[model samples]
Structure formats: structure tokens, C-alpha cells
Target: MAEFKGLSVSFAVKQKQDVQKQLFWPNLKNGPFNKLEDPVCCVKYCQSVPNFAVASGFQVEIRDPSANNAVVKNFHRFKSPVRSIAYRGLGSGLIAVGETNGHLSVHSVAMRTELRHMTAHTAAVTGLAFLAGVVGGGSTLSAAPKLASCAEDGRCLLWDVSDPQGQPLMEFDLSSASSSTSVSAPPADATAAAMDKATALDASQTDCNLLACGMINGRAYLLDSRQPRPALVLSHEHPVTCVRLAPGDNALYVAGDCWVRALSLHQGGRQIAAYRRHHKHVTDLAVGRGALLSCGLDGLVKVTDLLTYEEVQKYEYPNCGLLSMALSPGEADCLVLGTNDRWLLTRRYESPAAAAEAAEAAKSMSAAMKDPYLKAVKAYQVMPARPEDVVAPGPGRSRRPRQQLDQLDRLLKKFRHSDALSHVISKGQLKRKPQQAAAAMRELARRGALATALAGRPDVHVAALLKFVLHSLGNQDMAEDALPLASDLIEIYAAPRELRARPGIRPLFERLRALLAREIELGKQSAMCLGRVGLLLDTSAAAGGLAGSGGAAL
Candidate 1:
């Protein structure tokens, strides 16, 4: 194998163009590699988030990302591709790399030249992570940072990387047993029991210790270091692509099914936020204050606000897929992005002026709520706009309750499916069973209640329309003509493509491609019809006005 940029760049050679055209070949100003022999699979920084201490490939090279395109120092060499690399924390100076040969090697970046090496699995190692510094009795404790590894052999083993050739701290073989109905579960067939036994064996390592393991089945298990068994197991519809523990926040972020879910241990396993915003498998995630950056095989990089879970920025590459991301340790605004093509990119935070502009946009939106219908109505404010205050009476007087609309708004805001349904029922919008509330709403919109109630107060307009459609369709007297229109509307509203491609709904993209095509066609037709009618009215009014003026003169 030939070396370019100090790492192996495999010779698949699909492109004959000069190396200068490839971003990875153009040595970064701060990159360490000068020669690479194989295509890099994954790269990471050893110091902190984006501070590059060591860049790993088939053979590892140690250098800082801030150093000027300098030669990489020998950290360690392994037999297989460096699939996973991790560092404990700032200043500890320990670096760990897992390779495809089922070997894990640890080196001291700031200390000894060669520290320790161990073969921990029979298959390729896929995952590695460092537990944060330990704390006990409300105070800090100092000890060697422990290392964890997951492999294709279906085992996760813990190692003491502070010393070379050291024994594994603990070992867990998750696939020791398959599904069985035996009453007397023998030791060989007792995987769960063995897991519990392992938990008890490692009880001394507990405090502030949390081990997360991702299985080949797309399941994630949170195991308490002190307990022999997993504290929680979450299954994804698709194989779990990646799992990460957030620094500082002690939160667990897992990505699968094209979504990143933030789960808080502080809240007793409650899900804090679900960012359903990517169209393909989310392969990696890096968390920082106020925001999160996620990338996947689809070559899309998205930054999202931690508080609101709204995507703030999106970047795409032509053929490169992102493999990992790290935030710069020294600067809050700087980020380091690594991709499958062996290229690295840097991004800084939005300028203060840009932030101020964003704030101004938000303020303008808040100020636009001049209509009472669009403004939030509290339970107390929902009380009859005082019947006496009305210039003319409307039908809502009898059906409207002070808290009903307010409650609907609250439910929608919280994503409380049942609560929103209760409001729909209390307002006598859906005559069907309350359990079918969401479905009823969908049915109602299909039947034209959506168009009729578009003018309703912002809080309940959507709810009322949904209710109207459901009631109209469920009614026995409905006509066949109405059915076709309702069916068309339903298909339009429920278009899978529209739902998935729309921002923040990527997790539900099962139907996006189909829905998007129909929506575009329908939109064009609607625009054409509206334009034709407007032109017709304009001409008719002009002619009538001209004729009336002449008659008046006579």
C-alpha cells in the first residue's frame, strides 16, 4: 500500500483527475498527515471536541489539528482499519483506537510513547467510548479513565487502558444465548442471567458509570455499571446506527430511523427531545451547548438548536458522506467535520450580526400577531369575548367554552394526542368515539371542514375543521360527489412525500416521495384556476362600470 498524507489511501482509483481536485488531497493548513496509503474510514481529535491530537487511519498518526500541515508523529500502528477512536477528556492525554482486526490499542499522547495493546474480540470492533470523570459523595475523584468496546461478535468488553497488556476490567457477551423455552435455563443458555452476574461482578465500578451498548438488531440498552442487567432497552424500527453520551449534560443521544433522540438520565429515562429531521440513516452526532450537529450517509449535515429542536443550518456534499464531527475545545463557535472521502472541513459560529438579525426576525414574527384569532388565548381569556362586546352574534356563542379552545392550543403545543382529542369532543366537533380523535380529524379535513373553518380562531380553527370533516363523512346523508372531493383532499393532505420532505418531519418519511409528487401537481392546478378567475372578474367589473357611467350621464 502506498502512503499519502501519512495514512494509507487504498487504490480503488475511480477518478483519474489530478489529486488537487479532491479536497482531502490538498493538505489542510493544520492537518498532520503528509502521506496516506488507504482511504480513511473515520477520523477524530484526541484532545477535546474539535482539537485534533491524533488522526487515525489503517496506521495511526499523532498531531494537533492546529499545527501547520506538519508531519505526523508515530503514535501506534494496527493491522486493520481504525474504525473507532476516542479520548477520555482534556489533559488526561489518553487515546484509544479500535480496529477491524478485533484489536484495541491505547496510547498516552502526552506521556509514554507506547502504553498498552489488547485483542478484545473475535470480529471487527465497531464502537468505543470513555466514561466521564468519576464523582463520589458530591466531590470529584481521580482514577484511570476506563475504556469500552463493542464488536460484531456481539460482545462489549471494558478494558483498563492506563497500562499495556492489562486484563479486561469486565466482559459481557450479549449473544451468549438465543431465544429458548427451557424451564431450567442452563448457564450456557442464560445470557440475561450471565449479564446480571457480570453486573454484580463489576459493582465496584458503579458510581457515575453508565454503559450504553448498541446491538446488531438496532436495539440500544442502557446498563448501569453496578447492575448486572440493562436498566433500559430501546428498540428502533431499523438497526441502530450510532449511540453517543453527551458531555457535561450526562444525556444519552441515540440516532436511528433517520432521527436523533435526546434522552436524559436526570429525568428517569424520559425523552427530552426527538429531532425527526433527517431523510436517511443518521450515522453520527456531536453535541455542544445550545445546538447539535448530525450527519449521515445521505451526505447531509444539519445543525439543530438543543432547546427548540429546530434545524438551524444544512450543508450538503456531492458524493462525500460524513463519518464524524468534533467541536473545537478552545473556541465555542468552531467545529471540525470529517467525511468518508478523507476530507475535513471547519465551520465557525454565526457572527454576532447574524444572530442579531435572527433575533429581529423573531421579534417581527411575534409582532405580527395583531389578529385575536392568531394570538394565544388562555382559559380565562377564552370566556365569551363578552357577548356584549360583540357587534353581531355568531354561532360559536353556544358551543364555545372559556377553556376549550385554550386547552386545544395547549394540547397541540405539547403533542398530547389524547388531550387534543378531548377538546375536539368537548366542542362537539367529532361525533365519533374519543379514542379515534386523531383519525377523526384527518377524516374531517378530507370532507372540506378544513376550507370552511379556515377563518376560525387560530387556536381551534384546525381542530374545528378536522371535526367538521369527520362529522360530514360519518354522516349518512353525505353525497357521492362529496366523497370524491373528500377523497382527493385526504390524499393531498396525507401525501407521504409532503409529510417527509417538510422540515422536522423526516422521521415519518415513509410516505414522503409519493406525497410530494401529487402535492406539486395540485398546487400548480390551484394557482392556475385562481389566476383565471381573478382575470375574469377584473374584466367583467371593468365592462360593467364603464356601462353604468354612460347610463348615469344619460
Candidate 2:
């Protein structure tokens, strides 16, 4: 069972078990991106209005969510390509646009005219976001709004959009700061090294003062709006493409290359965990109610548990590389994805009839295992007995020396052949008895229980057995004894292509491959040395035979 807060839930209860659903875009009635001019660069949802904005080519189109059949005429066009777009706040219709020409423009959606235009960056601006407090809630729109933007020039600029005539409120040279303060500098290509540093930036939605930026050279920096210097820095092997601060402002989520990593800000920026399920670059991430949503260039959208880091759901869109993603604030299950194919796809979770069928099946399974003795036996076979379950000596009582053995005998009689062997292997390992475990494994192999276990639930103990085999093979004394068992187990468990592709199993395959290669080389060298020794022995024997013949003749 797993506990969350003060509530307990069964581990068998999958996150998506109750919500068996399919995701489809309802707005694709007229076809995907039929009205948009070109491929989408970015997408964002507006809070004040029931519409969404998409930047395609050099135009930013604002469309009504209630009517997705046609595009609205209310859009802002720029002379250069619009790389990024962001809304100021909930009640404010101000839209901020960043262009590839290093130009930043603030426009009013109601007026459909540019209010302020300035050269905020020397290169293309890649990211734009407003401070969390500047948007949402019931806050009045009377105060000036602050916007953060990152550009290819390696600079993160802060602007007071309210005063267009004034200069930038703050400027942070990410490239210079990183070069001077980074503990270990990352290797970069000539072009990337020559470019101005910062590549991406995002303001935290929970804390207005917190901001995060990613550099082209695989570094992520956390910044405080009140301070000029960075608060913390993180490095990755691949270029950092995106960085997002969680809603609590204590966790930072970063995506780069083919990985998504989480860092705990409260723990001085220690990495909490990393998820590498995506096959390509993870382009964006959105924090939902209790899950983290990520989209990648592999056209996979994965939903992972924030606490456990377990992937709960996955959606695949073949041949389409996702570049941007946004979750609807009004709908927890509603998600919008901007693709390289020039389409804005929206997905919403809807319950299906399969959920009812699954529930019925689970109920039947529970009913079948209702017998108390059978249930106990099944449980013992699946898991090792607890330490407290062993009968120990008490005050004024003599300890039963064979209590565990007696219990094992009773279980062995109650269970089937295969089941008994599995129980012995599991319990022996837990009890830290190597000889007992080896004997159980041998019995299982004799009865062909290894194949049965692999087919039934390979995830349960297959990895454990694999690790044990590898350890034994590494030991010079036990390698010969463990060779046959290791070969049989690997042939059964590693035969499936899908099983080999699993994240946990892939590393084991790599290690096995390297170990086998080394052993083959050593075997060749040993064979050559033995051949040389045989030649020397034959020469000495022939010489002794000639000497003996000479002595006999004399």
C-alpha cells in the first residue's frame, strides 16, 4: 500500500485504473491548423479571455476556444519571425511578443496595435514569460507588469512593460555570470560557444521572485528577482532546452536532450530524480495537479507522478515532433500541444467503459483468493516473511530452534511444486542464507520454474537474480559454477525486444555486453599461452627420448 498525506491507497490501484480514458482534440473539426499560416513556434492560453494564442511564422493568432472552426481576425503581425508570446495577466489584454530580430513588442489585444517596441536582446529571443503574481487571481490590472525574456545572445532581460519609454528594469548577463561562477564548464561547439549565453528562461508560476534559465551549453541557473547574481546553477551533459519551477517554488524541473530531471531548491539544488523515458529531446514540461506532464521531439507525452517519479500515462503522436505544450487552467485533464507540423492539438481525458470491465475483473480475482489459508500461502510465496513473524525466545520460554523450518515445511506442503520453489528462493534470500537460496534456485531450475517465473512476473525478481548472477560471474571462484544459471536466465529474460528496451533492463544489457567482450579477449590470450607451453613440452620430451636412445645404444 502507498500512503499520500493522511490517506492510504493500495499499490495495486494504478493511477489510471479509475480513469481509463482516451485523449482527442475536439477542435480538429475543420482539420489541424487549416487556418494558421505556417508551423507553430509557441502556444499559450489566455486567462482573461476564453481563447488561446498561437505564434506561427511572423503572426500571432488569437482564437476563441468556444469556436475552433475558424481563426479570429484579431492578431498581431511582426516584420520578423515571432519566436515567443506571453500574456501579461488575467484581466489585462496585454500580449508580449519576442521576435527573431531581437525585437520585443508589447501589444494590446483589444486595440490590436503595438504599444511598445524595443530591442531587448542582441539575438533571437527564445523564451518569454510573465511573473506568477502578475497574472491570475482577483488582482486588479492597475499596476505595471513585469516580463522576463531570454535570448540567444546569452542575456536574460527584465522589463517593466508599463513604461515603454524607460530602459530595461534589470539585465543579467547569463554568459558572463556562468563563465565566472560555474564550477565545471561544459564543452560546446564553436557556434554555441560564440553565441551570447542564455538560451531559455521561465518565471515561476507560484513565486513571482523566482526565475530559471537554461544556457545553450547545458547549464541551468536559478535566479532571484531581488538579487543580481544567480542563486544556484545546474549542469547537464546535453544542452539545457527548457527549465520550469514547480508550483511550490521549491522544485525545479529541467528538460534537455532526452532527459527530464527534477531538483529540490530547498535542499540547495540537489537533484531529486531523473526520468529518461523520452527517446528524444524533451521540449517542454507542465506541472499539473499531482503530476508532471512532459512532451518530447519523439512525439511522446508522458505523465509522471511528482512524488514517486513513476510514469502513470503516455500518449503517442507518430511522425509529429512536439515543440510546445500548455495545460488548461480550467481543466486539469485538458492539455494543448503545439507541434512542428503546424497544428495545435488539444487532449482531454474522458472515462471509457473499459474501466468498468477492469473493476469487475479485479473483484473476481479478489474473490478467488478469499480463503484465509490459501491467501496466506499466496502472500508468503509472493513476498518474504517479516522478521517479527519468526518465533523467537521469550521470557520463561524455550525458543523453538526449528520454528522457521517448521513453517517452511507447512508452506511447502500447501503450495504447488513451482509455488513452493518460488517461496523458498524468496524467503532464503531474505533470511540471508546463501546456500539455502542456491539450493532453492537449483530446485526451481530442475523443475523449469525459472521460465514460469519469467513469464508470470519477471519484474518481481528477474533483476535481482540477474544482479546476483553478474556478481557471481565477477567472482573468480564462483564464475564457473554460476555460468550455466546465468546463461539460462539471460536467454529467458533478455530475449524479448520490449523487455530489453525497458529503462531498468537496458543498463544491465550494456554491462553484460562489456563483460562478455572482456572475457572473450582473455580466453583468446589464454589459448595462445597454452599452445606455446605445449610446443615447449614437446621439444623437451623429444630431446629426452633422443638421450635415452643414445644411452641404450652405448
Q: For residues 1-554, could you state the per-residue lDDT of candidate 2 as single tens digits?
A: 11122225566554543332223221212223343567777877764465677788888877655564246635656879888888655544778899998899877766677777878577788888787664432323346457888887667777777674745777654654243322122324547544535667888766777889988788888987776588887776568888878877888888887677888888887777875666457888887666788898767777777656766666656567888887766455457788888878776543445547779899999998689998788888897779999877678777656645554456444434435545655664624755555555565456443333332234545566666666766778656645666676566446454354455766675677678788889999999999999999999999999999999999
TM-score versus the correct structure, for each prediction = 0.50, 0.58
Kindly give the number of clashing pairs for every candidate. 31, 4
- Relative to the true structure, candidate 2 reaches a TM of 0.58
For residue 351, give model 2's deviation from the true position in Å: 4.9
- In model 1, which regions exceed 4 Å deviation? 1-37, 47-50, 53-56, 68-72, 89-92, 134-143, 163-165, 173-208, 248-250, 349-554
Among all windows of 10 consecutive residues in model 2, the one with the lowest summed lDDT is: 22-31
**Would you list the clashing residue pairs of candidate 2?**
153-196, 154-196, 154-197, 154-198
Model 1: per-residue Cα lDDT at residue 151: 70
Provide the global lDDT of candidate 2 against the true structure: 0.67
What tens digits encode model 1's per-residue C-alpha lDDT throughout 1-554?
00112223345432322232232212222222233454445545543433453344765655444554343555545677777776554443666777777787776655535466777565567777665554111111135567777776556677666544566766543442543222122234345333322100111123356777766465666765444456766554455667666665356677775667777766665666765555445777766554577887556667665545656555544355666666654334445666666666565555446768989999999888566754555544676676777765457546554655565666655544334544665676444543344444554345333222221123233334334444444454542223443343344333454344343433323233344455568779999999999999999999999999999999
Candidate number with greatest lDDT: 2
